[model samples]
Target: MGNLDGKVALVTGAGGMRGVGRATALKLAAQGADLAITDVRRDASDLPPAEVRQEWHSIDSVSDEVEALGRRCLPRYADLGISDEIQTLVRQVMEHYGRIDILINNARAVIGRDKVPVTDLEEEVWHHFLDINTTAVFLCTKFVGQEMVRQGSGGRIINIASNASKQASAMGAAYSASKFAVLGLTQASALDLAPHGITVNAVCPGPINTDRMSYWERSQADAAGVSLEEFRAQIVEQAGRATPLGRIAEAEDVANMVGFLVSDEANFITGQAYNVNGGLLFH
Candidate 1:
């Protein structure tokens, strides 16, 4: 038997091949939690060139993996940027599972456009990041948190933040700002829900190995007039040399942190942003 044998978890952005969401879903399932996973069903227009598109069925594929671990899995498609969609998604999860004990807010929005300085950033782009990254967190926490409160059994809510939350980037003002807001949300929600046994926390990961990271690398490489291969090499060397731990992190590293946070062992922890960035930023 596992620590979460009877728990039900809802994870967002879980359809990527090498994502923190997929890893976290698997970790929670391995600990015996049934999963309700969501992903935006991407079409050709939503993606880049054929070569850039990841060839995997996001929700169905991950659901298969979760079920293989002997845990119930529900795969759903959701845009998540829309309030109505979020409400409906939460309602469906509660209806299917009876209760929600864990929520992992791991979905993010990234545009492949070149990274530009703050002054050159488009207004639409800024709102886009905030809408998907920051606002979605608020809406999900609001609705799902209400459900947890009504259930009266307490719960765990983990927001997937980034190293950007703590540090500013030269050409990443919008993205950094959104993540910083996520930290704020996590802390505030934690304080609000702590009295009822719920713990809210955020995890900040630095340069994890994921397909989304790869997409960013490609965009940055193009912006810097370097080939993708050269950019990849430079990033690996830079992260390895700069980080105190001598290497960047894998998706599993972040997932391990999420797993612990949702477990009973972390009952005393709340309202804190845990950094899993291999000592890149000390707070």
Candidate 2:
């Protein structure tokens, strides 16, 4: 039997194949939990804020993979920036599965090229990032927590955070600040939800291998007039030098932590920020 047998989970930010959310969703599904996956890029102009078309298959593919794991999967296009849409997502999941036991808040505003220092950051970018990254977490948790309470079953809530939560990053002031707020929300919600038999925690990952990381490097390379290949190598070397693990983390590394946190083994843990950074930073 799987650890999460008979459980239902909702994973946000799951459309990106190389993203942590996709990994976490698949991992949860592998453990025997039915999945409800969401991604921002469901509608035209989801990211980059430019003209585009809604590609439902982006999320469908994820759900298909989950179903292949022998569990039910429901994928939806979600705009966490809208409170009504957030509520609707919860309702849809509940209608399908009747209950939700695990909620993974993994979606965030990840426009790597748009990052800028606090002094140079535009107000629009700042608010946009905050709306999606920080505010969405609050909305998702608030709505999902209510569902868990109504179900009368204790549940688990895991917030995907970043190394920026604890340390400063170059040209990542807004991102860092947003992640820091996620940590705060995790702790405060854990305290409040503890009485309701719900557990809330945060996972902080550093320099993981993902398309997002690739884009991050490419953006830097462009600014420095270097090839993408050289930029990629430099980043890997820098991550290895700074981290005791001697390399950046893989997507599965973070997923492994998520799997553990949602399992029965971690029943006693809550309100803590666990780092999957391969010892990049110690606390």
Candidate 3:
């Protein structure tokens, strides 16, 4: 049997076809965990106005794949930015799955274009970013922790943070700030949940080739007054130069870290943020 056999996992933001969330969900399923997937669907919600154009429908694809792997999959569309909605979603997961042994807080909000500095960032933008990135983690952990404690089985919370949380850059003010809070929150939650046998950790990823990067590339191309091809080359070159590994990360690399952290092998690892950025930031 797989390490995650008989386990149940809830992965947020698993609706993207080529992103970290989808990759994480697949990894869990392959390890023999029943999956509960949630994604922000296009509807009237407090989340940002636009949704990225996706070539493949990740929501259905991930669910089908999990079921084909001989594990159950419950795919739901929920906005991570909404607190009430998150509570309801967790309630549904408990009712359906009976228990949630693993929670992957993989949802994120982006200010695609219109890069604003922290000083000039609108309150609305900052609040929106925090709502999805940091606040959702708190809400999900609170409810899921309750279920885990009740089940008498310690659980795992693997938050998907980013290197931007520590590094400073233009046009990433809201994202960086919210992720910074996530790292701190992960440590605090790990300490508090230790008594309950629950472990909380975070995976800080650097420039992975996800749909999020595609959007950013287009935006950067426009910003730099260059063709999309040129813009992509420049971005790749810059990242390769900055990273000690001479390349940005792949989605599977981040997924591997998350898979290990959530497994029994990592029972002793908690309240720590592992950097999956290919030696981007060693300090």
Q: Which candidate wins on lDDT?
A: 1
Deviation of model 3 at 74, angstroms: 0.4
Per residue, candidate 3 scores C-alpha lDDT tens digits across 91-152 of: 99988988899999998875453256667877887888889889999999888888888888
Query: What tens digits encode model 1's per-residue C-alpha lDDT throughout 6-45?
Result: 9999999998777889999999999999999998877644
Pick by lDDT: 1 or 2, better one:
1
Residue pair clashes in candidate 3: none
By lDDT, the better pick of 2 and 3 is 2
Candidate 3 segments whose C-alpha is farther than 4 A from its true place:
43-55, 213-216, 223-234
Each model's C-alpha lDDT? 0.88, 0.85, 0.82
- Per-prediction TM-score: 0.92, 0.90, 0.89
Model 2 poorest 10 in a row by lDDT:
44-53
**Backbone clashes in model 1, listed as residue pairs:** none
